[model samples]
Target: MNIVGQLAPLAFGLAVIGSGIGVGIIVGKTIESVARQPELQGRLSSLMFLGIALTEALCFIAIAVAFIPFPKP
Candidate 1:
């Protein structure tokens, strides 16, 4: 297989892995914050979702880049 073809999948996997780590950290903190302030559950939940979406978006961008053909030299 072509090197560039191999790289696309590698890049996609790394993007997903990176996003997962980021989402986990954000959600973990949100959970901790909610535990400390039960009444702020609603607000914390929204913030958590926002973070997840942003992180996921990064992965989507990576996927797009991976699929893109390298520019002609």
Candidate 2:
């Protein structure tokens, strides 16, 4: 296998790891905000979900890109 083939999986793994961290931070901050302002819980939760969806979408895109065939030099 060439460099691109070997690196694809590593790149996808990094993308997943980054997505997980992104999700964790989003939830943690959302919870902290809700704890401080109970009334804003509804809005904060919606925004949190939006952030998670966007982050996960990025992972999915990375997966798609990883599967694409790269031309040989």
lDDT per residue for candidate 2 within 1-73, as digits (tens), equals 6787898989899999999999999999999999999999999999999999999999999888988888887
In model 1, which regions exceed 4 Å deviation? Answer: none
Clash pairs, model 2 backbone: none
Using Cα atoms with residue i matched to residue i, what is each candidate's TM-score against the true structure? 0.90, 0.90
lDDT score, candidate 2 = 0.94
> Which run of 10 residues does model 2 get worst, by summed lDDT?
1-10
- Per residue, candidate 1 scores C-alpha lDDT tens digits across 1-73 of 4668889879988999999999999999999999999999999999999999999999999999888787655
Q: Point out the worst 10-residue segment of candidate 1 by lDDT.
A: 64-73
Model 1, position 22, has a per-residue lDDT of 97
Candidate models: Cα lDDT each:
0.92, 0.94
